[model samples]
Target: MALLALSKCYYLGNLDQKVFLNEIKEIIHFHQEHHNLTRLAYQSAWELLIYTLIGEKFYEQVIVIELHFVRETRRELEELSKCVDWKRKKVEREKETKEVIVLMRWLNSLEFFFRFCSFWNEEFVGLFGNVVQLFRASSGNHREIRGECIDFFREAAGNKIMKVEGLLKGGAIDAVLEEISQQSLNEDNKICCFSFFLELSERLQEEKEDEKEEAKRKVFDKMEEEGLDDCIIMFHHFLLEEELPFSYPDENLECYFMPL
Candidate 1:
């Protein structure tokens, strides 16, 4: 209907289109009018607006519009996550499961949108916990959704604007370290976790000319203190399995593994 037309227009419009604001406002109004959009059809309509905004090229305008609904959208996503049975034992009605699937897909799109926009606000930090919970649950069976959730964390953790102390206090770093310590963790998952740490380390220490090694050393020390020696050993095994050279190209890696 009208929403569909609006979405098409916005998607086709250029970055500087003047009508974007009006369309954004109208979509927000529609969302507010139907607050509880549990029905799959209605949620699909709601997601059209999200998808449109995500695909838009004008980041400035998109940021403003996204922030407008970020809180409510996150709340709705949290509720949907709660409804999912992570163990896959509590089978939901087929229609309801389909609805949840669509909603989660919309959440995946939102995560992508947040990537280009700054999501370091207090609200986003709060939402991060729910996202992590969903990530843990999605790990059970929903592979694609789990990857999307991980990407959300990856983007947030790598965002230079994100407060390092706040992220640390939120237990994000600790959770990652713990995840890496798990023996059952796959190589790809380990790589993702390590990549986040590398990006985080780079951003956090980017300004200091000589403290990069010190920062990396602190991470290694924490990992060891947390009894992650096995994890490091596994990482070495991963490198060997990949047929990479025993020595890294970077000189700083000389002392990375130590005498363990």
Candidate 2:
């Protein structure tokens, strides 16, 4: 809790920048060395790191690169993912379940960062592949984790700072369409999937007119190759089965309904 409080204080400009940076460095080291910490404590430390990164001034500090923040966080998540045993019952594997929950928290934090923070560069590209891997690994169960992954993709797509090429290289299109095809998705996640696709389409449209057509063709071809037709059928069935209250604008709706 103290770590979270410190993050909040730093975000609100109540803490001196140098002091907070030094404290954050110490916390990062502590978190890395203290593998025995409770899951809740570890999660709080991650939240602190994420919150601090959201601050533009803090993000610009050399400490972000010096400490290898992206690499460390990615490695931590990858390690935790290996600990999850989906075949076992949640009660029997409580620790693994907690790890899954922590993964979800990490996803949510990254999504929030992508959405609100304008800072984007090559340093953050590796995390995109991490998100894709988590999405694929959590398939058939852990709907919450998958939903968080979709939300992350949605925000990353909409964030103008992120290039569409980065998303493509990360296999985001395949992940988004694959998630949309899952029957277990709840209404909210279904909406998020559509939003992700819409955002991707909008991002593609931002290219020069000549490049725009080629980009759209490539995405459409990829979508078709990925069984987009079946996804559309499933989505149509979903619309009939559930009375979703939220309405999509015509332009946004066209992305789905337009002839392939």
Candidate 3:
């Protein structure tokens, strides 16, 4: 509750910039050292971190090195990832499921923060490699984690903050496309995967005309190698076979649809 209230105050501009940065640094430190925060606490901490970064004050402080938010956050994420044994059996990992989900959420939030803030420095760019590693470590049976991983990829690819080539080279394309190819994914996740491909294509279009064709060829070559075309065909077939809530009228020309 205190974290939520603090986030509210920060959002309202009631908190001093120095104080808020200090608070954020402390929170990041705590998270780095502690891996047993409750789910609600993690949610509140995530909200607080979002509020901290959404404002310009944090960015200004970061630029002048008043705060080590980026470096600290990277360390926190590294420590958090260490707490989860992704290779363990499902039964063994059941106790850590909540932490795993929290980790994914943090990754999504950090990716968004970096993208929105345009933090494209070497320090920030290095984090994308970590995102790919976590995504690769994720179990195929953990749909929620994989879904969030897909979201991180979509956000990373949709924006100009991170180069598409870097992401592709970091194995993001392979990890995401492999997950999308899983036969057990539901329709919603399949749609999310499709959006990632679309965003990737859009990002590629942003390249210079001279280099655009080659970049597209390389990305599409990787996609084809991962069987993305087959996945799209399968998703299309699934959509076609899905039943609609309302049916069309026959040739009798009578209106059969009714509004709720």
Q: What is candidate 1's CA lDDT for residue 86?
A: 63
Worst 10 residues of 3 by lDDT: 251-260
Q: What are the lDDT scores of the predictions, listed in order?
A: 0.59, 0.70, 0.62
How high a TM-score does candidate 1 get? 0.61
Q: C-alpha displacement of 249 in model 1, angstroms?
A: 7.0
Per-residue CA lDDT of candidate 1, range 181-245, in tens?
77777766766776677667766665352364476567668878999998767755654576422
**Off by more than 4 A, model 1:** 1-17, 36-67, 89-96, 207-260
How far is each candidate from the true structure, as Cα RMSD in Å?
Answer: 13.1, 13.3, 14.3
lDDT of 2 by residue, 192-232 (tens): 88878778776766644447458656766776889898765
Instruction: Give RMSD (Å) of candidate 3 vs. truth.
Output: 14.3
Weakest 10 consecutive residues, lDDT, candidate 1? 251-260
Off by over 4 Å in 2: 4-19, 29-43, 52-64, 89-96, 209-260
Model 3 ranges off by over 4 Å: 4-19, 22-47, 55-66, 85-98, 209-260
Displacement of residue 170 (Cα, Å) in model 2 is 1.0
